[model samples]
Target: MIDVDVLIAGGGIAGLVAAAAFVAEGRSVFLVDAGPGPERAATEDSDLRSTAILEPSIAFLTEIGLWPVFADGATDLATMRLLDAGGRENAVRTSAAFAAVDTGRPRFGVNVLNAPLRARLSAEVAQLPGVRVRFGCAVTGALARSNVNTVALDDGTRVHARLAIAADGRDSRLRKAAGIGVRRWGFGQKALVFAVSHPLPHNNISTEIHRTGGPFTLVPLPDRAGVPHSAVVWMERGPVAGRLHALDDAAFEEELNARSCGVLGPLRLAGKRAVWPIVNQLARRFDGPRLALVAEAAHVMPPIGAQGLNTSLGDLRALTALTRGAADPGAAGILSRYHRTRYAPVAARMAGVDLLNRAALAGPQPLRDLRNAGLRLLDATPLRRVAMQVGLGAPQGTVSGKP
Candidate 1:
């Protein structure tokens, strides 16, 4: 029997970080992935997604000793600009920008490319004292019981642990084994993600353009080859996004520049394009028996507002704290606390994202006008500051500590 204090299924950033967190608390962990090595998975050619790491989230990573790696590669987000460029060309509405100064901070957050983040976290976890990682291996089956949970791997190995965490993502086998059901719905939209270089600098600002199909966001990235680059998330109706994804590089750049409304000046593709179906999902429960779900295994929000991974980190934060002092990391009490702390908030966040996405995707001109007006109003008032704080996943009442 391969025994460990905790068994984390899924070798994504979340899973690796969870293992690191547990090991930091002096617990033993076995981490497994059904895919290639972290280094292979994180290469720019493999994964094109980027995560905007908010201040608090960065602090959590720092506590786990993995921030330095990210800090070296991330681009700071000092401001956020939203433009309503949906509807007809003549009907395009207001544009607004929110600066971090309103929140008393020098910058709101930092955007880090996924590949490097994963590579760093994976490397760090691999070197931790009490963590064992098995890449390109999967948890083929799981058996949960009153006192312990055992997982069977494809290689005929079995792992016994006091707690099992299902970080395997949306199609989590561990979650199914734990009998946890999820409420999921598709938005009939897909997100096209890639990197781009603009003739003009972004000046450390992140921009989101709300158009009829969905939101087109440009998030800052560290300069490359003496030029400025940003990661792009272009959302559109399913078929439309598919068509756009099929466009030649020249055509894609032309369309991207048009959608951007010349805000960043002419833009050109800096990396390959990748598409993902947009969905909203929340597991019915965060815990089951001796198991718990974190990250996408627990909840998935639309790519809007940079909420997806941040919400996952929230789950890790709660789970790590709940299991910190527990003798049995997967004990009933600890699992229950994690569920109670995460469930309602996650559900609420999913609902909010769903509503916001609906507004962004609404077809009616009146609805689009209302949405744009509301965004303009919010931007013009002090409320935009509050919205900025909340949108960035900032803790309530957190003073930026800036005089």
Candidate 2:
């Protein structure tokens, strides 16, 4: 039997962040993951698919001491450009300047590929004396008592810890075993992510363009071999996208160009394409007696605006703070506390994203005009700017430090 202060299930972003946070607080952290395979990698160089770290969220991670390790490996996105298709307006543009003025931050956020970030986190965790990691280990069983959590491994060994956390993906086995259920639905769309080089420089600008089908996100990457490259998330109707993905590179790019409306002045494919069938999901129950869910296990938003992992990190942060560097193993009160901390923000964001998506993709001309006007007014007015800041995860009251 193995024992530790905390037992974390799933070694993805949320689990790693939670493990790292507790270890930094001098808590013995043990992580168990079924293990990651290269087949899941977005590109050959990165084992992680793709994820964006938001500004404030990055600050939180920095406070926990994980940012420096990622500095050299991540890309800083200092500006954002939002385009409204079938409309005529800039609506809003946010820059590091605006963020510094509005929130007193130098940069809003940094974008990093998953593989390197994951690797650095793994390496850093390995160096921490309080952190223990077991890859290639699957949990065959789990039991949470009032004082601790016991997990049975596939190999017949049992491990005990003060708490067991589920951060595995949306369909979390740990969550299932703990009686957690999630509401999941296919968005009838698929997002195809790949790297593309453009003749025009992205200029540190990450962009989101809304269309009838869905949003197309273009995030900047470093200049590669003197070519300006960007990471693209082109979302389209699932049936069409499935057929598009099955085609050869030339055919896929042709279809992608048709979807993008020549935004980047002709996109030249630079990496392997990865496709995700879009879905919106959230857990029915965030926790069981001793088991708690974070990240995709707890809630999953559509990939719009980098909500998936960011919300996951938020859950991790709150869980760490509420747990206060100690675990009663699978304590229900602690689990409830963790769930409560995450419930509001997670549910709010889920509804908000769904609303935005539905509104942005609405077919009715009148509703589109109303949403567009609201979108425009929100950006053009100071009152709306503050509201936008709050919607963007700034502290509830103000961007000032008092909160």
Candidate 3:
């Protein structure tokens, strides 16, 4: 048996981040993924989604030495603008902009395309002496024992480690093998992800427009060839999204522009469109025996507040902190503490996001009116700042730019 401190299954961003964090703590790690390498994954047209990395998560990556490389291709998020168009012919009814300055911070967060971020993390992990990344390899099975957990790989290799963190995404083999059940439900909505170039600058602002269907978000991205650009996540009902996806480039661009409400002037497609169904999931247990679940393996929320990956990063952060200096990485006490600390917050956040999504999709006019009114009220009071702080998942009084 090849012994290690941590054996991570699934090679997504969360998996790679976990490997880097564990190695930074002087633990040997083996990471396996069935997909292509991060660099290759970045160049693929199918993986065009971008992530808005919160300030706290950026700091964590910096501590582990992965942020510098990712920073090169990232764009700052100075403000988050929310527009409600649910009332009256989908026109902008009410708008609120949450600025980092309101909280005495320079910027709220930054947006990075997933492919480049994955590429950088992959590159960094390859050079780390204590971490090994195995591409095109999948975790076929797992067994949790009293002292350690064993992972079976598709390539006929076996790994024995004090703990195995499942970052394998929403459908996790390790979680299933560990008998950790999850609560999952599918939203009839589908998200269309792509990049666009605009004549006007985004000014580092991320915009989310609420309509009868769902949110259409435009997140800032670094200029491409001197033209302003932003990544777009347009969510609609499954049938509508499918019809839109079939439109010609020019037709789709027109629909996209209208949905965007011309916030950044005219828009043109800069990347291929990728679609994914929206889902909500939360594991009943974060850990069992010598095994622990992190990232999507633990929970998955809709793309509403950029909480999906940020929540995953929270999982990594909590797990890394709990395991530090522990004699047995997989001690039941450590796993129990992780479950206690993480499960509630994750569940609460999931519920909150679900509520917001449901409100946005509410068919009743009275309900929609109430939802918009609540948002306006929040914006009018000090609760706006508090809400922004809570949404960012940062502690109160924590400055954004501080390391």
Candidate 4:
């Protein structure tokens, strides 16, 4: 049997960050996942999504000494532009721009491709002193004792840890084993994630265009071969997205350019495309016995606002803070405190994003007009600043601090 301070049951972004964070705090960590190890998975051409790592999340990563690993590859997001083009003509009606400087920061966040970031984080975690990563092993089951939890792995290894974390995906087996329920609902929408190169520069601005089906967002990415590139998350109703995904390169670019409203001139596919179903999910509670759920295992939100992974980092932040210097990191009190500190805030954010998505999915002209009006209202000076701060994960009444 192997003994550790924490056992993590996923190796995605959240699980890797959890390992690094806990180990940075002088805790021993054992992380297991069912997929192939990072070295192999990183080489595979999967997980084509990108993440916008906001200021607060960057601070947390830098604190744990993991930011530098992928910093060079990150593209800074200096501004966010919201455009309403939900009219019948598919043209822009109202536009609002929010600058990072308005929030007293040089940049709002950094965007990184998910695969490379995971690869770099995995490499870093593997070398950390207090971490043991079992990439191909699955968490079969667990026995929660008063002090330590005994976890069984598919490889026939048993682990005894003070805490067991469910960083697994939304459909998490560990959470089910703990008898934790989730509230989940899906929109009849899907998002197509891909990279595109454009003739016009993104100018470090992330643009989200709201239309009939959903919002089409283009986030700045590092230049490729001296050409401006951006990551696109184009959301549409189920059948529409499927047809778009099935279109040939040339045909798809035609549709893509029309949807973009020529904002970036013309767009050419720079990479492969992948489709992801949109869903909103939250676990009934963040903890059960010695197990704590973080990231998708805890909550899953739409891609709007870049809330998915950033919020997961928030979970790690709260968990690390609550357990620091504790005699038993997984003590009932510590676990309960983590749940209390994270649940309500996460649930509230999920609800906010859900409402925004529904507004973007508005099919009626009147509803679309209402969304545009709301956008114009938020664009005002004071409200715009507040919106930017809140979007960057700053606490109420404060701006996001430097990392």
Winning candidate number (TM-score): 4
Question: Is candidate 1 or 2 superior in lDDT?
Answer: 1
Report RMSD for candidate 4. Answer: 2.1
The clash numbers for all candidates, in the given order, read: 0, 7, 0, 0
Model 2 backbone overlap count: 7
Question: Which pairs clash inside model 4?
Answer: none
Model 2 regions more than 4 Å off: 37-48, 87-104, 325-330, 364-371, 387-392, 395-403
- Per-model C-alpha lDDT, please? 0.86, 0.72, 0.86, 0.90
- Cα lDDT of candidate 1 equals 0.86
Residue runs of model 1 more than 4 Å from their true location after superposition: 90-92, 396-403
Q: Is candidate 2 or candidate 3 better by lDDT?
A: 3
Write candidate 4's Cα lDDT for 181-214 as tens digits: 9998977889999999999999999999999788
Tell me how far the alpha carbon of residue 254 in candidate 3 is from the true structure, in angstroms, after superposition: 1.9
By lDDT, who's the top model here? 4
How big is the RMSD of model 2?
Answer: 3.6
Indicate the worst ten consecutive residues by lDDT in candidate 2.
89-98
lDDT of 1 by residue, 200-289 (tens): 999999998887788889999988998999999999999999999999999988888888888888998986899999988889999998
Clashes of 3: 0
Q: Which regions of candidate 3 are displaced past 4 Å?
A: 395-403
